[model samples]
Target: MRTLGLTRTSPVTFEEAERVVDEDGHGDAEENPDGLARVYVSPEVDGWTLVIGPWCDPCDGERAPEILRLCTELSVRYGRAQAYYYGWQGDGSAWLVVERGAVLRRYCETGEAEDEFFALGDPLPLERDRREQLRLSLAAEGSGDAEFEDEWKWAAFDLAPEIAEALGVNPLALTAETRVRGTGVLAVTPHRT
Candidate 1:
């Protein structure tokens, strides 16, 4: 796994990362004392995980473009890379797998993969209905907070087939063999096989 342009200083415990994220509202946006970007490590189903920019605010509408630009820059620097952005609001999110600065696959709500949710050829109407049902279910279950809502949105990329299926997206299509590149900005362990 590559660091993806992030600077890894001292190791941080998941508890500490969670605390900082809880206080600051973002894990990847902050800089360390040396003025380098900080990457947080947390536990994941596969193994430990490292992630940046799970930004969850609808107010940050400008962030999408910035994230895209950053993705482009990172792809240029790293050769091949994948980027995913989730929008908490109705705008939906985008997933891009790029290689050598060219996008191998681009998936989004309004793109070629639009109907490829949870299942290939899932009708748009059905997808919308299922998403609405999920939203309502989350609301009723008292998981309507911004954080959980953000989690719900990002569940589309879950490595688990059953989880992605529950979210109305095909697990096989969602899988990617992404190599870690760049500095220390990105890396997932144990790396997805």
Candidate 2:
């Protein structure tokens, strides 16, 4: 496969994986128990697992909120935690990395934590488009209370539900009640098919 214009044909060694992980601004490896698939999230970010999806299902959407609710609870008692995810495209599987929570950095060779890494590409414009669409949608919904603070808080809540809830409003209603003027949640709800 192609990686930064280079073609590779083997799996990445633990060393290679660690390099990529570090270059992407992930914290040091000693902090990671698993090495490759493991990421160094801050205690706050560590508190949640942003659920990707079960496309076309609002229940999947509901699940994200549920996770936030749980994380909120966990954060209160357990402090915070971290989690990881990988991509599964069509049928072929391979190595990749979740960069800055948006772009994917696909590896040229097979590797462990195959589903967790995403190949690199433009993530910001897409996120911008999504925020615009969401803004318009929320406006159409007659919720003019749109604001970035809420979106940022929502993102933290989305990532760590237990922390969000522990601090009120069940997740479902909170998200539904919330609207966005600007967004801080980088990961979008995966496309529903």
Candidate 3:
């Protein structure tokens, strides 16, 4: 057992976890502050165990990308661990398994690895302008009372279509309310065509 790729020597602490890896491309860990986390990879499976501060959130602006990087590195070094990634929701953070630029699966405190949710690939080149516009507009809405409602409306109407195209799935059709649900958008499997 060569210890797959990366492994944790001890219980990874928050300070050690946020010490920063490849900072130039991933940005500063301090930027994420309380959200810092560490993933220890074992050489056997390149198995990774995530350690985090009690307040980390995977969806937070700063930490999400770092978590993404950890997944990317794991996939690259280990081929693909069935464990994918693990996050502790008690800490408001999560881990996922990404391969070849796509989030293949995710693992939470729950026992199983989930596949229903995944990233929709990179944004379409043409949608760059539109996405920026939406981002700016949504930023203006900020955390106002109406922000949630307004943002959902904008995403459904303005952003979903482009994102759908980028992901090669029809957003309108993926929801259960849509007739095409379960027909078009498919879980990409190793063997499925």
TM-score of 2: 0.19
Task: Give the least accurate 10-residue stretch of model 2, judged by summed lDDT.
Answer: 1-10
Q: Which of 1 and 3 is ahead in lDDT?
A: 1
Say which candidate scores most in lDDT: 1
Model 1: how large is the Cα RMSD against the reference? 12.2
How much does each candidate deviate from the true structure in C-alpha RMSD?
12.2, 18.7, 16.4
lDDT, model 3, position 35? 27
Per-residue lDDT over 5-98 for candidate 3, one digit per residue giving the tens place of the 0 to 100 score: 2222353323333343223114344543332232322111112222223222233334455556654665576554222122212221123445
* Best model per TM-score: 1
Higher lDDT: candidate 1 or 2? Answer: 1
For residues 82-184, write the lDDT of model 1, one tens digit per residue. Answer: 4444433434545554445555444443222322331212223333455575653423322446564444445443322332233333313323443323232
Each candidate's lDDT (Cα)?
0.38, 0.28, 0.33
- Mark the regions of model 2 whose C-alpha exceeds 4 Å error after superposition: 1-59, 82-85, 90-193
